[model samples]
Target chain A: MRIETKTEKFDEPLHLESGRILESFELVYETYGELNEDKSNVIVICHALAGSHHAAGRYANEAKPGWWDKFIGDGKVIDTTKYFVICSNNIGSTFGSTNPLSIDPSTGKEYRFKFPILTISDVVRAQMKLYDRLGIEKAVAVIGGSMGGMQALCYSIEQPDFTDTVIAMATTAYTRPWAIAINKIAIESIRHDPAFKDGFYDPDDLQAQGLPGLAIGRMAGLIAYLSPELFNSKFGREYARTDGLYELFGRFEVERYLEYNSYSFPKVFDPLSYLYICKTMNIFDAGRNKDKLEDSFDKVKCNLHLISFKDDMLFFPEEMEEIRDIMIKLGKQDQITYKMVDSQSGHDSFLVEVEKFEDHVRDILKGK
Target chain B: MRIETKTEKFDEPLHLESGRILESFELVYETYGELNEDKSNVIVICHALAGSHHAAGRYANEAKPGWWDKFIGDGKVIDTTKYFVICSNNIGSTFGSTNPLSIDPSTGKEYRFKFPILTISDVVRAQMKLYDRLGIEKAVAVIGGSMGGMQALCYSIEQPDFTDTVIAMATTAYTRPWAIAINKIAIESIRHDPAFKDGFYDPDDLQAQGLPGLAIGRMAGLIAYLSPELFNSKFGREYARTDGLYELFGRFEVERYLEYNSYSFPKVFDPLSYLYICKTMNIFDAGRNKDKLEDSFDKVKCNLHLISFKDDMLFFPEEMEEIRDIMIKLGKQDQITYKMVDSQSGHDSFLVEVEKFEDHVRDILKGK
Candidate 1:
C-alpha cells in the first residue's frame, strides 16, 4: 500500500472555543482508495492524540507502517477496496496540520503559545471543511478510538446528518475528573521544565533541551495506557542486566521500555502542541451546556456503535455502559449498539486487539 | 503526650550496601513516654518515605501534628501510656537523619550524591544501633506501614530475637515490578531537572530551583497513594473556578489537590535524599539473596502480623496473601496473623483507616 499526504489551505477565519479566531489555517490529510461518483462510500477516520494523518501504509523514507496500518489496509477491517477513507491531522496537533509549530501568516513567526486553544468541536469543524472540499456530502461512517472516538461523536452531533454511522471505541461523551487530573499533571510536567521557557523556547532547541520533561509526561501517559495485569505478565520482577551486575544500576524491564518511549516521543512531538491537545481533551464534554446527556445525544442523528475494552482503566467499560443506558432511556436503543472487548492491554486494547475489533467492525460495515 | 527529639553521634565508620563507608554518622530520633526499667516494654515505630521522627504530638511553633499523630498519642492505638515509643528518621532521609544533605565530618560539606546508596536492611541497622544506645536488649514490638513496614520486616529478619513481635501494614516482603516501575519514573523526574545538577546543586538554591522536579516526583507519588474510588468519591467531575469562569483555566478538584502537594513537598525534602530513599525501597527485597522467601523468613524469631489494604494498588492484598501462604507452608501459621482492611484510600488506607488498623493492632499487642 502507498500513502501520500496532501494539504489544503482555508483563507476564511475560523472561530475557536476560546473565543479567538484563527485568521486562516491549513489541513493535512491522506486518502485511501478513490471516492466514488456518488461519494456514498466515503468514511472519515479520526486520529487520536499524538497521532497523524498517516493512518495507514508507509512513506518511502519511513521505517515503520502508519499508526493504524494493521486495520486500514486494502483488505483490512476498514478496507480501502470498498471504502474511501480519509484521515486528517487535528488542528492543534504537531503533525503536518496547522499547529502551534506552524508559522502565523500575520505575524510572520511560529504561533507557539499564540495559537488559540482548540476544542473537540473545532477539530470536527476543520475536518468537515475537508469533507466539503472533497465533495463528500455524506460519509458512510466516522470511526475512531480514544480521543479520535471523541471526534467521531462530535462529528455525529456537529453535522447531524452528514455521517450516516458513528463508530466510537474506548472513549466517553464527557471527560472524567480522573482523566483531567492525569492530563493536568502531564501538562504541568512540561510547563515546569526549565527548557520549556513558558512554551517560547527556540524551536531548534525544543526537542533536545525539553526532552526530559516531554519524556516524563509520556512515561506517565504510558503507565495509564497499560494495565497492571499486562505489566505483571510482561515485566514482572524482570531486571535488566547492566555490565553483568544486576544489582548496581540495573532497572526493571518496564522502566527501560518507558524510558525508550519517553525519549523517542519528543523527537516527533512538539511540547507546546502536546499541551494544547491534552488541554483540549481535558475540557471535552458534549453535554457541557445541555440539561442532560440525552439532550446532547438528541442531536446525534447517525446510527451509533460504542466499543469499550473490559480492562481499559482510562475509558472504562462502565462509562460506555452508562452511555448505552442513557441512549436506551432516550428511546434511541434501536439506533444504538454497545459491545465490550475483553482484553488485557488496558486502554491500548483498541489498537492492539485487532481481531476483536475487526470482527465487530466488519459486521457493522456489512450492516448486519 | 510530650515528645522530644535527640541525636547521638558515633565516631566509628558505618558500612553501606554499595561497598562504601561513612567515616562518622549521627542518628536523630524522637521518644514518647518513659522507658520501663526492664526495657522490655519498648516499641520502635518506623516512619515511611518523606516522614520524620516527629511521629506524634505537635512541636513548638508548629501548626500541624505529626504524620501518625492520630494513631500514636498517649491514648491512641500505639498507646504511649503502656509502651515507650521511639521513631527514628531513616538513614537516607532529610528529616534530621544522616542523609545526602548531612555534612560529612571529613569534607565539611554535604554528601550529596557521594552518599552511599542505602538498603532497607541498612535503615534497620541504624535503628538497631539507636536501640543499643538506649540500652534496650529487646523490644515488645516493631511496627510500621508502607516503606516503614519494609523496615519492620528487615528488623525481624536481621535481629530475629531483638524484637518479640512485628506488625507490618500495607507492604510486601519482595518489591513488585509495578512498584519498582513507579519509583523509577519518580526518581527519573528528579534526575531530569536541570537544577538538580547531578545532585551537586548549591544547598541554598536546591529547594527553589529544583522544586519543579521534586514536586513532579511528589505528584506522581501522590497518585499511587490514592485509589480510583477515592478520586471518584472526592472529586468526581467537580471543576475549580478561575475568575468566575469554569472554562478558561478551570481544573479538577483533584488537580488542585495534587498541585498543592507538589508545591509544598520540595520545601522540606532533599531531592537527592528522595532519590536515595526511593531506590532503597525499590531494591528492598527481604528474600533478595535467598533461594526462596521462606528461606528469608526462616530466621524470624518473632510473631508476625501482616495487614494489607483491599484497594492498595502498590502493595496488593494478593501479595500479602502470597506471604501468608508461604508462612503457612513453613508451618508458622500459628505465629502469623493476616488481616485485610476494606478501604478505598488505596495505600494511604494504612494511615486513613485508623479504626480498622487500631482494632487489629490492639489485638496483636494484647497477643489475642
Candidate 2:
C-alpha cells in the first residue's frame, strides 16, 4: 500500500521520434499498492503538466499527500486494497526523475533546453520499459487525467497488448486547437522569461529570473484547471486588507488566490521541467498516428472508459465522446464505457471532485 | 468633422480614491465629428488600457489606424458624419498623454510605479476636464469597450448629466474574478521581469530583460482576445518544418499568429506600461458606486446599449445580460437595449467583425 522507488539506467539510447538520441539515461519511478502474483492488477496513473510520481500516499513525514491524494486512498476507486498501482514521473519531469534540470552524464551540467523535444509516446515508451523491468506483462488498466490521459491513450494504442483497460479522463486523443494555443503561450512565456536566456543561464543565476516567470506560467494553467464560477464565488470582490479610514487596500479574493497559486509554484517546480511537460502534452495526439484517428484506435486493445466533465472548457466532454465513438466503431463498445461527469470544476474535476470521479475509477477497477 | 486636440491642467491636486494626490496634472484629448449648435451631438469614447487620444483618424502618414478605427470611421458607428465624438487617452496611459512614463516636473524622473492608483471614475473626471477646456458643457453619449466600457458605465452613473446616453460593448460592468486573475498574472510577470529592476532600471537596460517579459505577458492577452474555434479551424495540427518539431519555431499557423503578436508588441510597449495598464484595468469596477448596483444606475441620465459576444469566454455574454437586467430594473428598460452578437471571434469581434457591429451603432445614432 506504500509507494516504493526504483532507479535504473536505460540499457540503450532513447531514440526520440526527432531522430535525436539520448544515451543511457537514468529513470526514477514509484509504485503503489501490491503487484498481484499475475501482475493483472497493475493500474498506471499518469500525472498532469506539473504532477509527479507521487500520485498517492506519503513518502516522508514532511512531504504532502500525493497529487490525487483525495481519490486514491484505501477503499477508493483506485483502491490500494484490490489493485497494484504504478506512477512514474515523466522522463523530462523534475520529480525524482531525469529531466532538463538533471545533470547530464557527458558534461556534468544540467541539460536544460538541450534536452530533446520529448513526445508523450517517448514517455510512454519509457514507462513500458519500466513495466517490462517490473515483470508486469499486461496491466488490468492504464488511467490518467489531462496529460496522464494522453499517456494512457497512447499506451493503450502503441502497446495495446500491454494494457487491457484504458481510462482517459479530461483529455483528448489529440491536442485540440485551443489547447495547442494555450500550450504554445505557456512555452513562449517560459522561453522569453529573461532568466531563460536561451536556456543556458547558470542554474544559480537562473533562479531569480526563471522562478517568478514559472510561477506566472503555472498560474495560467491554474486558470484552465478551475472554474470561473468557483473563482468568483470564492474571491468575489473581497478585499484582503482595509486602509481603516474609508478606503480599499487589497484586491478581490480571486486576485490574492491567483497570486498565492503563482508564487507557491516557483518555490516547488522547476521552470525547465514545466516547459518540457507542456511541450510533450502539446505534441500528444493519437490521431497523428498514421495521419488518421481510426488507425490510432485500431491499435487499442483495451476496455476503454472515456470520462469527461460538463464545464471542463480546456478538455471538452464532446472530445471524449468522439474517442468513445471511435472505440465503439472498433467493436469495443461492450468493453468501453463513456460517462460525462456533471461538475463545475472545469478540467480539474478529476483531481478535486473526488467523490464522483472515484466512483468511475471504482467501476473500472472492479471490472464492471 | 476632423478629430481635434484639446488640453487642460488641474488647478489643484486631484484626490484619488486611494488617498493619494496627483498635484498639477494635464489631460489631452481629441474630438471627432461635430457638436450640434446646442452641443447635444457630443459623444465621448473611453479607450482601453494603453489606448490613446488618437482613437480615430490619421495622426501622421505612417501612423497605423487607431485602435478603434474600425468602430469610428467615416461611415462607422460613432460616425463623424453626424454625432460629435471625443476620445481621450486615460490620465495614466502612455499614449501622447501624461502618465507614469512622463517625466515628473519636480525630479525630472519618470514616475513609474510611483503613480498613484486611479479608478474608472477618476479617468472620466479627467476626460470631463478636457470637455470643459473645449467649451463643451455635456456629452450626449459615453461609449467604450473593455476598460473603456467600464469608464462609459462609470460616466453614465458618476456624471449622468454630462453623459446622456451610454454604450458599453464587449465588457463587464465590474472587474469579474477572471479579469482580476489575468491582471494579477500580468502584473506579477512584469514584477518578475529583471529588466524592470523594481521599476527603476534604465530604459536602455530593458532590451535584454523587460522586453521579453512584456512580450510574454501580452501573449496571454492575445489568447483571450480570440476564440478557441478560430484557433483550431485555422491551425489544427499543421506543422512548419515537420510534424512534432518543438522549439521556438512556428510549426502551427496559430504559433505563427501568436509569435507575430508577441514580437510586434515589445517593440512598442514598455514593461512599465504593461504593469501600469494592467493595474488600472484590474481596479476597474463601476458597480462599486456606493456598494449598491441600483444606487449606481440611478444616476444614469439616458438610454443604455450593452452589446456582448456570445462566444466571449473571457467576458461571458451572460454577464452582459446580467448587467442589462440591472439597467432595466432602474426604470431604464424603454431606453435600454441588450443584445448579444453571435461570433466566434470571442472578445476580439468588436475589432474583427466590424460590419456586424455597425448595425447596432446605426440604431443608436440614427436620431442624431
Candidate 3:
C-alpha cells in the first residue's frame, strides 16, 4: 500500500476555468541535492504513466532506490552535488498527489470518478504554477521518459522561457495510432469490467473481475514495453512455476509476472486515477498541431535531445528518425541531436538502462 | 459463413478406448490432381488449427479460392497436374470432421463435451487409418503448417515408410513455455464462461456466455500470429469509429480488425474442439527421443524441407536454425534444405505469402 502525504501549509489555492477554487492542494515531491546559492542549477525530472515522484534514492523507508537512482546522486549525471533536483507526482496521479481520491469540496467526498479529464498541457501548467509559487524562475534542464518525456516536450513548447534544455527519451511528442490503439484497449479492459460500475464503484467493493481484465490489459501494455526479441529469448516456452500444475494448465513465466504486477497495482493505486492518467495520455499527441510535421516540431524552442531504442517495438526507431528529419528540415538541426541506443529491454530501457543514458545526458549538458 | 461438406465415407467401424464402437466416421477431404499408374505420386496435406479440408482451389459456388489455393493448384508448387494431393479435416476438428457434435452410440445423443481429449499422434494415426482404407501405400510428400506441420513430423517419425518427403513449415518439435501459456489462457477464458459448464453447454443455446471469452481468446491468438511491425504498418492509431460511450476505446485499425475477427469465429466453431486442439499442440514434442542431434536427425529417412519466416515471432527463426544445423550434422545436408523468407505477416506468412514460398517448393521438387 502507498502512503499519501499532505503539507500543512500551502501558499495559495489555484483558480480554475470552471470558476472553482482548488484550496491548497499539496505538491507531492521527492527531492535530492541542495539548491545552489544562485538557484540556477535546478533540474526537474518528469515520470511516465504509473510512475510516482520518487525519482532517486531510498524514499521513506522503501528498500529500493527510486526509479532513476542510478542517474542521480553525489557525482552522477546532473551531479546532484551541484544541482537541486525536484520531481513531483502529477496532479492527476494517485501516489500521494491531489488526484480524484483527494477530498472534493463540492460533496465532501473523495472525487472518485468525478475528477475532470486532464491534458498533458494541463499537467505541465500545474507543475509550472507550483514552481512559480516556490520562487523558481527557470530550470537549467527538464527531462523525462515515456509520459515524462511527453511532459518535457510539452513544457519545452508551451513554456520555452522557463526551460533551457529538454531531453525526451523512449517517448513521442504525441501518441501514434499504434500507441493510441494499445492504450485504448487497456482502458476498455478496465472500464468494461462490471466491477468498474462506470468508474463510480464503491472503493470497498473492488474485486478480482476488474483486476483480471485490467491485468490482461496490462499484459498487453507489458508486451509493448518489451521487445519481441527479448520476450523470445528470456521467456520463450518457459514455465514460470515448474510444478506439476504447469503441465496440466500450461502456464508461462511472463503471464505470471503480468498477473502479479497488475493485481499488485490496486493495493497502492485508485482505479479512477488509473483511468484518468491513461485518458490524459491518450489525448497526448505532438502531431496534432497544424496537421503537418514541420509546423508541429517548429513550435518547440528548447535545445532538444531526443533518444530512442533500436529494439523498442512500441516506439519504432523510424518515428525518431522522422522527428530528427523534421528538426533538420526546419533549420533547427544545430539545436537538436537524435541518438538511437541499441538495447533489447525495449521501451522500458529508459528506466533499466541508466549508465549509457546518463552518459548521453552528461554529454548533452556539456554541450557536446 | 463457411459451408461444411461431408463427402468421403469410411467403410470400417473403429473401436474407441471408451469401450464403444463408432459406426461410421466420415472423412471430410478435398483432392487435387489425378492419381498416376502406381498411385505412388500422391501427397497428403493436413490442415492446421481452424483450417478445413479445402486446402486449394475454389468450390463450385464460392468466389474465393481455398486458403492454400495460391500454392497448391495446377502449375503451382504442389502442382496438381504432376502429383495427386489429398487434404483432410482432422478427427477432432469442427470443420466437417468427426468431432464433439458427432452422435454417441450408447445414448444416441450428440457427444458435445463427451469427446475425448486428443493428442497430435492420435490425429496422425486417424489420418493413416483413412489412408489405409483409401488403399494408398505411400505418399510422395506430407506437408503442413503450424499444427499441421506437427502432424506431418509425427507421421514421418511414426511411419516413415508411408512418406517420401516431409515439409514442416513454421512449426515446432515441441510446444514451448510461451506457446503453452498463450494456449492455456485462451482455454481458461472459454472455461471460465458461465455457459461452458465444463463444456457441457448445448450447441443450440446461442448467445452463450463463453462467446465473449472465446472472442477475447481468439483476439489473443490473432495477436500472437502477427508481428508488431505488421500491426504497426497496417493499424497504427487510425480511428475508424468513435462514440461518447468510452474515451480509450479502439482508436486504431488493427485493434478493430482483431476484435472483428474474434467476433466472427463463434458463428462456426465449437468451443470444445478449440480446447482439444490446443491441448494436443501443447504437449507435442518430437525431440523427446533424447538422442544426440545427429542420431535424431538420421532417424528420419524421408527428405526434409524446413521453411521459416524472419518475422514469425511465434516460432522464432533461431529455432529453425537449430533444426537445420541438426540435419546438417547428420550428413543429410544433401537431402534437407532450409529457407527463411522475409515477411511482415509473422507466423501467418506461410499462408499469406505465396509466390516466394511456392518457388522454393518447386525448386525442391525439381531436385534443384
Isolated chain A TM-score, each model: 0.96, 0.92, 0.89
- lDDT values of the candidates? 0.82, 0.76, 0.72
Docking class of 2: acceptable
Instruction: Give the distance in Å from residue A192's predicted Cα in candidate 3 to where it truly belongs.
Output: 4.2
lDDT of 3 by residue, B278-353 (tens): 7677667676433443555667888888888888866777766777788787777876778899888988998998
> Where does model 1 sit among the CAPRI classes?
acceptable
Name the regions of candidate 1 deviating beyond 4 angstroms: A207-210, A243-250, A289-291, B106-108, B208-210, B243-250, B289-291
- Candidate 2 chain B, which ten residues in sequence have the lowest lDDT sum? B241-250
Report the lDDT tens digits of candidate 2 across residue range B136-230: 88776788887788887887778877765788888887777777776666666666666667778777656543366676677778778787777
DockQ metric for all predictions: 0.47, 0.49, 0.26
Q: Write the per-residue lDDT of candidate 3 for residues A11-39, one digit (tens) a residue.
A: 46665423345665667876678767767
Query: Over the stretch B264-332, how does candidate 1's per-residue lDDT look in tens digits?
Result: 888778888888888788778889843568898878878988999998978889888887887888888
Best by lDDT: 1
Interface RMSD of 2: 3.2
**Which candidate wins on DockQ?**
2
- Better model by lDDT, 1 or 2? 1
Top-down TM-score ranking? 1, 2, 3
By summed lDDT, the worst window of 10 consecutive residues in model 2 chain A runs over A242-251
